[model samples]
Target chain A: MLEWTRGQAVGEIDTPALILDIAAAERNIRAMADRLIHGSVRLRPHVKTHKCPLLAHKQMAAGAIGVTAAKLGEAEVMIRAGIPEVLVSTPIVGRTKIDRLLALSRHAIVLTVVDDVGAARAISDAATRVGQKIPVLVDVDVGQRRTGVLPGEPALALARQVATMPGLVLVGLQGYEGHLQHVQSRDEREAHWRASMEKLTDTADLIRGAGFPLDIVSTGGTGTSTFALEAPGITEIQPGSYVVMDDHYGTVQGVGFEQALFVLTTVVSRTRTTDVIVDAGMKALSSDSGPPRVRGIEGAQYVFAGDEHGRIEFADQGSNLRVGDRVLLVPSHCDTTINLHDHYHVIEDDRLVEVWPISARGRIR
Target chain B: MLEWTRGQAVGEIDTPALILDIAAAERNIRAMADRLIHGSVRLRPHVKTHKCPLLAHKQMAAGAIGVTAAKLGEAEVMIRAGIPEVLVSTPIVGRTKIDRLLALSRHAIVLTVVDDVGAARAISDAATRVGQKIPVLVDVDVGQRRTGVLPGEPALALARQVATMPGLVLVGLQGYEGHLQHVQSRDEREAHWRASMEKLTDTADLIRGAGFPLDIVSTGGTGTSTFALEAPGITEIQPGSYVVMDDHYGTVQGVGFEQALFVLTTVVSRTRTTDVIVDAGMKALSSDSGPPRVRGIEGAQYVFAGDEHGRIEFADQGSNLRVGDRVLLVPSHCDTTINLHDHYHVIEDDRLVEVWPISARGRIR
Candidate 1:
């Protein structure tokens, strides 16, 4: 549907369109690259935030070693688009998924995380039968307590089991502190960040002391990448949202990335003097964190009216907006909002230039 | 992806799949038809809950007059699928959308709602340019200050303006009491429902008294459908979410519809004795209302862990679950959850019978 938007002006495009500012996005990618170019830690930004392979290539060209994905289906999309090295950042379980993983391992170097022994043995058996050595990292739970083995003895135990398996290679440790990515204060964020990093590094040394290879200790995100640079042992970083920052990440104290993404909406109705309605609502924009801010419109507040409409109430002069007018808004959460649309309307020099399909938008399985 | 599941067993399907129970859904459709078959208010069930054209055809087969869509892109999908009548339940604004609406009116009897006189004029001018007479309805804001005009005088004023405009016919009024849809108490829901209905009917009479034909006064939803059946002067009810119930509707006392939809997920990690992680998370299930319920798994609470994983912790035996185990969950809100998937795996007698495309899942604009 968005393929025809190329060669058209920006304002002529349809409403409720996911827009990507090319210049700003390029600047953001370069900024992240410049942050890690001189460090010992290599870059492998997560692909979940921007589900586009073209953007992944941009990051790779800027200085990234590879890309990190959250699911097998997402990895498949990137690999099919010719991304060579991909690390699925989550554990891969079940029969069909394991079979798919083994099949995918034949095409590219695919590495996944593991926290349980039974699941690891299953993958080991499947890989041995297919004559493939799949690389794996021990997923250690520093503090989030969501998914991952506990640090110290527990993480080393999983690492030991992974190293002895015939068809698997234990290459590294993946300890991501997702819980500390959005801490409002820089001091509190770095304090928790250093604590989580200490646990991860101690576990990495413990596994290496037991005579296993733990070379690639990958971690970090947009809000804590600078802290990762300060840490000593992390060999790679996976900061995703810095490339297209949202309102949620912008509020963090030290995050200096410009907002490169927005939802272009249209004023559908102006019934009352103080209230107006737009075409973007909960279905168009995500609201898990909070409401979106009205960009380029002053003294206006946006609230979800329904699945298809958003209410924007103005404080003075009722925004001076009329029916069929356009408004831009920065979404609350970039990852979840990007997962809802099919493509991103690329804007360059205030003109519609390209439409890139979000190849892995609904790749939940 | 789901095409091969048409002849396979239900247990072998992939994780995070949206499922529709054929028997249970047919029973729900029949129950809703039986509820309003003897009354003057016919059914024009809203298709926003189930974006499937097959489900819309099933509703029509059960004696629904037409289908109500929330966007023009959705109405275009349903109309292209051979449904003869569609009523777009929201206001259609902007140039491209009005042109698309005029083009769609040539194929089906398309009716849209409008609250502002300027938008109505834009739609009328476009229809007249194409030599078409598009039906328009005055959307009345009964109590939900979302998208409609104010109830009494403002609604009548808009109706009068629409009556004299060329290429448009003033059909009726639509006042949906969305704020009272999920009221937990039946007495409170009915009290507010009756008051909203009185305002709508009074405005309908006022418009008709001014020599305008205000025949249709449509409103209702799954939460307050029985109360709408008791109210007078509501020509038809637009009760969606009845054919496939969710936990949001199940919490309401009097909405007695069977749960016909679920998301099938698999446990991806079981590191601890008390907690496990599933493949479904915020991307698989919508959490605007709340978290989804773990079906057929007792004493386990589901929390969104990330964009691609769910953390389910058990109270007693920790769900008696292992890695690669299957789990079923009822979504909190059906409409927003269905918009996340591409297709529905239809199960009849516990076997995958068909895979229907969600034709209008991303049809926001």
Candidate 2:
């Protein structure tokens, strides 16, 4: 789709390009797939990070059971790309969204999560009209407290309600501990992750005790997936960011992922003696956590000058950054940064060899 | 493009929708036009905020001399939509971008800004090869120091070099005071703006005193357009965010722009007694400046939970937000937030009647 930078050399590539180190990314994919392929659990990598079905297919080929999509639109993209099974990780609530959910059910085994009885009833009514039995999962509040029902009784009650509905099958429980994904210390992360996993498996037992076919207990992110693998009843782990690590995740202890993604920018303005301005800013690279770090440029600070310019202030006064020089910035947050671009310039051995479209990039609906 | 939410009701519109308040936007368009119609300094409203050709056409119809696009890709979008003139505000660097610049000069009057002589020569060589005379402005650094040459001799030297080039016309000088855009006090903002204008006008006079035809002096933004209009040598002002004001600009003192954009979200998870979760998060609404403000909820505070969720906590304990309730969030910055959506759900009389595709939404290359 993006035809401008297709056959250009690595030095001649345009600024503000989302460049992916394909070799490092494939190593990351193999590392996570290796961790989960031999365990009792499996990997259901989330599609929200890469938004590319080619990367998802590689994970599926390695040994992922299915792909986890955060929204119904993402699930549609994955299902249409011939991804057989997709778990809509978040709860789908609106009338138009639930209608879309039933439409997805007609094509593939689209499993979705629900935190409220009303949301479950809405999905059930829409699916019943279309003559389909959609698989459902009750989301339990496992200390993240952003979504999901309370662990023991309330989650069981919602599952009981879903069991009574006609066009739904009670499949599993999803309890995500997103709050523990960024803990700095490994001991502290494991301690907190065990507590969240205890509540998830406990709630799963309670639902199964109530005569429900609760098989899948899907949870965990890139930070907690390794620790969550040691837990009892988690059938799968959904770690999206491990395939393309950023500064936010690379700093955490015991996470073995390397930096695989970068925003390639060109130095457009270097008139200042103390700083040089690049063509990447809030519109090019996101600053949700903090400003992106300049790769291989030690002691260089990046501050967003405006929406389309980034100023890099080097610690040394004799920095030789000139106009048209290329610079790479490591994103602080990968998910939001990747959503800003339309494609990825796949790089290998410092050469831009291919361009891949981020197909479901802004599929927020 | 987006076909799912085309015929939906305003009440039942999908979550995480970019809704535009057309009435307030029209008033914003008229207010700036009325202030500049009888004055010498014209308006060239920046298109990076709305990124819509329809809105750009409205501004041109009112009184704007032309539109200011931040990138050449955006200029291609506007020129294809029949806009006669577009000033690419940022510098067009590198081989690929300059190639795009020459291609645009064949269609419309595409003006660009440059601060580096190496960059200007690159643009000139390409334009000379194509046999097209491109208009250019020397960017002068008033105070922001992000881009542009220093305001006195450095700018004059660059303009002298540009005048000697084969296929380039040295039009004017541009000095933008981006750092002073958010000064809280009106008197303080005016004082700093005047000091910056002195450098800009002094540089303009110095360049014009030479045998150069320095006709168009371009500068100013949404925050400093009023003060820049009062300066003598300022020929045209470029203010972008006045069309759809956000919470960041709404808190400033004398800016009379109202809120005209909102990210419509739905309460998908309301489990905790302290907080409820919506479907807008870092991916839906940007958090570069800060979190998006809750539009009408008086005491509610919003924090991004994950990629596709937002958690809102009310000051009062008895807030009656349940599941499936709609909420509106005013983006902290309009330009970056608008880049995340593909279309705008235009709102009129509380109805979602029209869906206009943001043809230039992600034109950052």
Candidate 3:
């Protein structure tokens, strides 16, 4: 357990703590729900960003149809949290992970994505051993060439193979435009998002024309959720970072989500007149995207001090920082930054309301 | 607990696991000890890289004067592990961390680094409340420009203030040249290392001449330990990454440490004929430095697939990869990569010998 308890002041919480603004988070959740209310697409918010069961429940309460997870561990956590519908967004290969995915079918409507025929066969074999039938989505490579098959014939062939395989159901197609999520220009992002959706919808038509059952066309992230909602065939949008927007996602033009997640740190060392050192660093906030933004501290730029400290450089010679002064930092990447901490110090205004455990933290397997 | 037991085969362990080659780790430990035996400088290995008490004990058993930690949480874990001397290398501010640090002093010889007089006074005041005197070292900025005072007058002023404050003992100076650790060229790194040591030694002399007691002059890392061992007035070297050399550290010239740490993963998805996706991604192996290198697999390049997958691209046209095949990955950055895992699957060749818990895995505060 953490040192600070509920009902404590925000300044009284320990340094280098993960802080969550409940008001802002709820606002963001409501905003996403309202945006997709009248559209054909429904929300299946990804739990990979927050990895908290409580947050997943909040998303579900706000009218999310289901939740999307990147790993089997996350799916298991969501299942235990009583989240009935979970789409395992990443492909589950190998005997161990496939067996775990098969076991998850007993508790929830578990759907996994697959790009390879060999992986499809593996899942079918594992499900056959467990006497269960698993629902699978054909992962299509729209633009990002990371982990998906090509859209037209390749996806159709894999769906056809999955249809023939016993103990498996070819449900839908998952085409994620990950590369277009962070484009600086809104017009460019919209253009790329529309093109990727076109590719995904065309491939869905191709698979359905081949006498395969394909209902859900899941896609989009926080950056492209609005565009995906208005698309022709994307039935579900999976946007994770909208709930707790970070500095990186906040920079995307016209994304009206408020920054809700922060790393509360203390100014530990202030030897130089130009810069002060905070207790948060790579261990407290991930720097894979870039350095986090110091929230509400005007003329301050956060720099990577080391693994355990952050250097905040001020524009003025005489700064407002002193030793032990608390500061909030908006992480650059929400998904990786949330993985670094154990608990989220949930705050309402200036008071700590609760400490929620990051249930799926360190669940790499 | 992990899925596999001791003495199990390497193939039986779960995917995306942190594996430690015991033989290679012991050899790396002995290599550092042998290199510093005849020198005036002793080894005070930093436990931030591995963060495992069992590995720290192995280093101390070989030859280590003390252990250096980056946080008070790590110090607490080290103290519980029966490590006699622990020096916290980062400045700890606030009442919560100070109270914990003071409590740790009752069990072991504890030391902390401070750059500002305010932080020095905070530690002194906390120690006074507990009726125990605490030893502190003046942290000098040598070149990192992160958390340290500007070497000569600033460091001397803090040391003098610490000398006047009751319940605080100014015993040493800590000057780390962190920027010179991975300069790529051996000559350039050596030049920077020598200059930083000269600055630290000169600052130590100035503080001692000003009637302040300064004995230990701690400096060095995996890249500059050899140069630090022969530098004049430098009493100890704090190199953490030598025990578990990563891909980034392995690229440095003349650092002959064997790679001991590996993230064991399985091939999960294969969409392209040239690329196969593994289960270890940024969450399994830290990709802040670069993508991890695939070990022993010739003509293979590792690419970041997503948060939970790594796409391994093969140079050869025909590959032998299939679902469930295990692959070893050398992490790009060892410190952050080690923090992402909870256990280290200790292996001796093809056999799993032991499972060591990462006792200080998420001790970031």
TM-scores across all candidates? Answer: 0.98, 0.98, 0.97
Q: What lDDT does each candidate get? A: 0.89, 0.88, 0.88
**What's the C-alpha lDDT at position A13 in model 1?**
77
What range of 10 consecutive residues in model 1 chain A has the weakest lDDT sum?
A1-10
Cα lDDT tens digits for candidate 3, B1-365: 25777787887788899999989999999999999898888999999999988889999998898899998899889889899999999888888888888878999999989888877888898789879999889999998988889989888888888898898988899998999999889999998888888899999999999887787999899999868666989999899999989999888998889999999899876667888878888788887788999988898999987678888999995888886788998999999999999899999977899988999988988
User: Which regions of candidate 3 are displaced past 4 Å?
Assistant: none
Q: Using DockQ, rank the candidates from best to worst.
A: 2, 1, 3
lDDT of 2 at A343: 87
Interface RMSD of each: 1.2, 1.0, 1.4
Model 3 chain A: weakest 10-residue lDDT segment is A93-102
**Per-residue C-alpha lDDT of model 3 across residues A22-85, encoded as one tens digit per residue:** 9999999999999999888899999999999989999999999999998889989989989999
**DockQ of the two-chain complex in candidate 1:** 0.79
Per-residue lDDT of A52-86 in model 1, one digit per residue for the tens?
99999999899888899999989999999888899
